[model samples]
Structures are given as C-alpha cells and as structure tokens.
Target: MTGGVPEGPGDDRWGSDGGWDDGSLDATARVVDADSSEEERRIEAALRPRRLTDFPGQQRVRDQLGLVLEAARRRQAPPDHVLLSGPPGLGKTTLAMIIAAELEQPIRITSGPAIQHAGDLAAVLSSMSEGEVLFLDEIHRMSRPAEEMLYLAMEDFRVDVIVGKGPGATAIPLELPPFTVVGATTRSGLLPAPLRDRFGFTGHLDFYSTEDLVKILTRNATLLEIEADPAGVEQIASRSRGTPRIANRLLRRVRDWAQVHGRHVVDLPAAEAALDLFDVDARGLDRLDRAVLEALCQRFGGGPVGLSTLAVAVGEEPDTVETVAEPFLVREGFMVRTPRGRAASPLAWQHLGLTPPQGSPGAGAGSQDTLPLSGDVGRFSG
Candidate 1:
C-alpha cells in the first residue's frame, strides 16, 4: 500500500520473507504440487500413516499430539477440537485420520468450502455421534456464518437451529453429542480469532527432512510392491522438495519407468531417467521452476525485472510465475523479490552455471558475501 509496493503476502499474495514463508512455493511443480488430483489423492490415502506411531516426521507435533490424545483417552472423553496448519502435502489430512483412529472413533470428512452457511454446518455437526471426529479440511476457507456456528458448537457441544426467517424466526437449541473437530488449513492466518481460539490444540506441520522423506519413500515402495534400491530411493528423496507427498509421487513415477524399461527394480538410472522425462531436475525444480530461473539468469541477465515481464519471458501468465514459480525460486534462495522487481540470487547464478557479472546485483559484489538484490533476503519463516 506504500507507494504501490507489496508486503506480507497481503495484496500481492507474497509475504515479506516472514509470514507464509519457508521454502514451499507450493503449487505447479506438478510432481511436487501442494494440491492433489483425485487419483493422486486416492493413492495418497492408501499410503498415509494410519497411526501416529507410523507417521515419520514432525516429531514435536507428533509427541505433543500423542500426549493430548492419550490424556483424552484416559479421561474416556472426546479430545479437544484440534487444528493442523501448514503448507499443503504435509499430511494434515493424514494426521486427522490418525487422530480418529487413535480415539477408535469414526471420522466424518468435510471441508470448509463445503459448508456454505450456518445451516449447512449445523446439519453436519448435529448429526455427529459421540466420540466422532469431524475432519474439516481447508478450515480457513469456511464461510463466516458457518465459522460462527462452529464456534458455539465447539465450545458448548450444541448448535442453534433456526425455525424461520427474520422476525418470525425461532432459535431451537440442538444438543450435539460429545465429539472432536479436527480442522486442517494451509493458511491459518485467514482463520478468525474466535474460530481459532475454539481449537484446544494447533499443530503446525513443517516440510519433512530428507531422512524422514527417505523413510517415507521406503515404506511406500513396499506398500506399492515396488522393488527400490537405496540409492534410487535416496535420489528421489533428495529431489522431493522436502515433502513426503512429492517423494512418494516420485517413487511411483520411478516405478512406472522401471516397469516400462524392463528393470526389475527402481535403481538410480531408472529414477534419473523418469525424473528427466518429467522435466524435474536434481533439485526437484520442474521445467516451469527452472524456466523461471533460466529466464532470470539468462534472459534478464540475473534480473531486476518485473514479475509480469519474467512471466512473459517464459510464455506464462504473471500469476503462474508469481504463485507457482517465483515463490519457490525466491524461497529456495535462487531468486529475490526486490523493490524494483525480481532478481536472481547468487545461488541462482551458481545453479544455472552462469557467471554473475561484476558490479551487477546478485553477483556478490563489494564486501558482503550474500547477494539477493534486496535489504532483507531469506526463506520464509512460515
């Protein structure tokens, strides 16, 4: 808003290397897309950890959640309404399922967008059985009316059913059975204060470590009945963009390559070939990601270029470049968003194998070593 400049993932869909930050650019890697397709989602469901013990990463969240669930179980009552927030593909849905399983309760799956009104949310909440877990995904996207209704339901285990409209309307209080609400969101900040406070526990999921991703891939390979070498699995892990979903997807894709090429097992070569075919590089940078980087390093001479111009240089829409490619590029330290526009970082120059010219931005010129063409440059904390 200051002189038409963007700040804090507000107005521009990008935060100032703080909120909504972290290396998750989170979209169109396709292979590493945060969003999922129906088939991909189906496969992901089959591969998800059914219990907390089986969940590979987020050790802190897992342990904390285990204590909470165990305490609730000991008390012989439904646990508090839980909130899981993080970048997509970090197993929020899987954890929700695990919570239900731990409680030995049935889970009713629904999303925020699905409940458009107070009545809609009330209908879903009122019919729930005692000890049931209502898993609300994309919890931040719920309509305000539904969210308000949820506040009362979560606090009092009751909902008010309106009999009529306006002046003639009668509020009939409906008592809901003891139940738990497990809400998952990628954007927790969008949630209102009242809605957020209603949740007893909030677990923020982070990107998986490479070792954790490796363990996940190995387990998934066995589940898929794919013979995979350690080296091959490691290769996949290294390129998974620090996300388990991406690792598993890459493993399955590599399995397909092995099956097609008559290889009995997924080896390093098979993994490499499959990844190459998909245009996902060693760093899990797909064509679009790399294209953005290439356009910056090569076309724009390491940039100071506008987002729109960068998008056009790659024959893509600006939003695509902004949301899909640029976030990853900036987050990975390969690019930076500057006052002037976008600029490549020193890492980008190094990754592209191009020389950062003397006296130009991102060339590591002068005394300071880091070069991002901005006053503040680092991965997002979110």
Candidate 2:
C-alpha cells in the first residue's frame, strides 16, 4: 500500500476504483464521488476482482468479456477495443484491469480528463509496449483533438504527430505497437458515433441485486478480516443503493462501529447504527438526495422546476444534482424529468411521509380530474 494507493496488477491506467472522493459530509459513506484518499483508493483497488470470473455481478458482461478475452488468448493477440458503459461504482475500471490480466499484457492507465491535448494521448500511446492494454476512463469527456487522435490509434495502431508551428506543421505518422484499448464511460451517448463505432464490444453494466451485493460485502468482510453476521451483511447490502462500492464502504463503517462498541462481530444493530451515524437511510437515501426530494415535493409543490432551480434550492451544483443525485433518484422511481423540468414521483411523496397533494404533479390520474394534462404543459411518463 504505497501512500495508501495499492500497486496492483492493473495499476497501469488509473481505471475507476469507483473514482469517488471521501470529501464533504457525504464522505461518511457516500458512494457517488470521484475523489478519495490514496489509502481508500488502494483499499478499493485491493478489493477489486483481478479475474473476470471472480467478479461479483453483471453476469452478462462477465460472460461476454470472457469470450472476447478467450478468443484473443487463443489467437495470441490483443482483444478488440472494448467500451464499458455504466453509472459509477459498477466496476468498469476493475474489468479493464481484468482484461489486461487475462491477456497477460501490461496496461497503461489514463482518463479523458488527463488527455487534454493530442500530444498527451500521443505520448501515452506511443510509449506503450506491444499488446499493451490502454484503459481510458471517462472516454466520453476527452477533448475533440485528443479523441480524433485516439480514433486513428484505436483503429490502425498509429498516430499523426504534428511537428513545428501552425503553418509549417508536418504530420509525421507514428506507428504504435498493436495494443488493446479498453474505454470506460458513464455517458456513452456523449461519444461521437465514429469513436463509439470503433469499439468491437460494448458492455453496459447495471445495478447489482441485493443478493449480489450481499456476496460482495461478505467477500469484503472476509478479506478485511472483519467478523460480520449474515443479518449485518444483508442489512448493509439492502441500504447500499444497489452498489458494491457502497456496500463495502458501509461494511467498513460498521466494522468501525463494532470495534468501538466492544463488539467482536457486526450484527444488524451495528449495521443500522453505523448507517444512521453516516446519515444514510434504510432506502440508501443520503442527506443530499433527501434534500433534493424534499425541495422538489415541499418547496416546488411536486415540481416541474428546472434543474438549476432545484440545485440552488438544495445548495449543490447543477452538475451534482444532475449526475450524482438525479440518476439514482430517477432509476429508483423517486423522480422523473419532463421537458419543462424535474418533478417528484408519488413514491417520493410517500417516502418523505407526505401524501401527494391532489392536482399536484405526483397525484396521478385521480388528480387529473381536477388538473387535466395540457398539450403545452410538459408531462412526465415513467
């Protein structure tokens, strides 16, 4: 554990170790972050599954990836460029490393944000040895020029290095070693068709089921040498927001609680206490998430409020509201986005212990009698 960041089999490219920071109040146990301490990162890296077969969830992606890697192994060549698309914390980066491990190749890690210029990408690509795996995280956010350069590199294993000033610039073709490029992104739609099309396989990761999360937390407990009961593990898994990273994080917090309380084993009470201390509810809604839901239902009267309005009301960046809070909320059926704005669902009203006001956005067809849908008015379906 070098400076809290473990050097592991796939440390080459800074693939996503769930890529979240343990900063702010959310650090108590928030899983939807992009910054974290080196120690925490190392711990996460250490916990990652090095082999695809060892991976916990996303069975479809796991099996498909297995075939792709196996085929390449038989051919003794690098596998096709792979694109991993999913929300944060679903193990895109871990899968990238597993690809390199299965292929028995060195991997060079980098992110779209890191490669601001074409030169940045060219440098990394050109330095790669034969059959190296280039794991690029957040590949959708790469700069246009860098992305253009990557197109050629991914397709032909070559890059155009421009030398000299603008008018005198000479395009020298740089042939890179035949390498496999594995790209991970939270937003695949943002990628241009040309870039997306270059990928030979695209794997979309979805949320882990409670059973899968339980398996992940149980494995983590054994690895961390923490004594935890099945009830404790299940309780933690249920409130982990359907994320393995969150489940592991909650397990660590529960371990701390157990140690402090003089309990050798983590029990359901300890799990509940730890989660309560961290301000995560039974449904995995954090303070920030609750704040958004409350603001929408209570302040905006079930909302049709714009994202900026909602963000300002909740004291968070619009991006955070959109990216971090909204996706989960939307996925969990607590909120809906319409052409006009975001609105709370009836479930959101119920979760907050309030009845949906008659004629309100969430009040349903019964309220439609009083508040008919207007052609010009935005409607939220599903």
Largest lDDT belongs to which candidate? 2
lDDT of 1 by residue, 91-126 (tens): 988898899889987666667776788877876675
- List model 2 lDDT by residue over 1-382, tens digit each: 2322224434443324432121101111223246777668667867888888899989999999999999999998888999999988888888988888888776666778877888888867766678878788889999999999999999988999999988989999999878898999999999999999999999999999999999998888898899989999999999988888788888988999999999979999999998999989989999999999999999989987889999999999998998899888988878877767888887888899887777788787433333323564445432
Write down the TM-score for model 2.
Answer: 0.87
Q: What lDDT would candidate 2 get against the real structure?
A: 0.81
Give per-residue lDDT, candidate 1, residue 320.
80
Q: Once all C-alphas are superposed, what RMSD does model 2 give against the true structure?
A: 6.4
TM-score of each: 0.84, 0.87
lDDT of each: 0.79, 0.81
Q: Looking at candidate 2, what is the lDDT of residue 228?
A: 88
Clashing pairs in 2: 4-38, 4-39, 12-109, 13-109, 19-34, 20-33, 20-34, 20-35, 21-35, 21-36
Q: Model 2, which residues run further than 4 Å from truth?
A: 1-35, 364-382
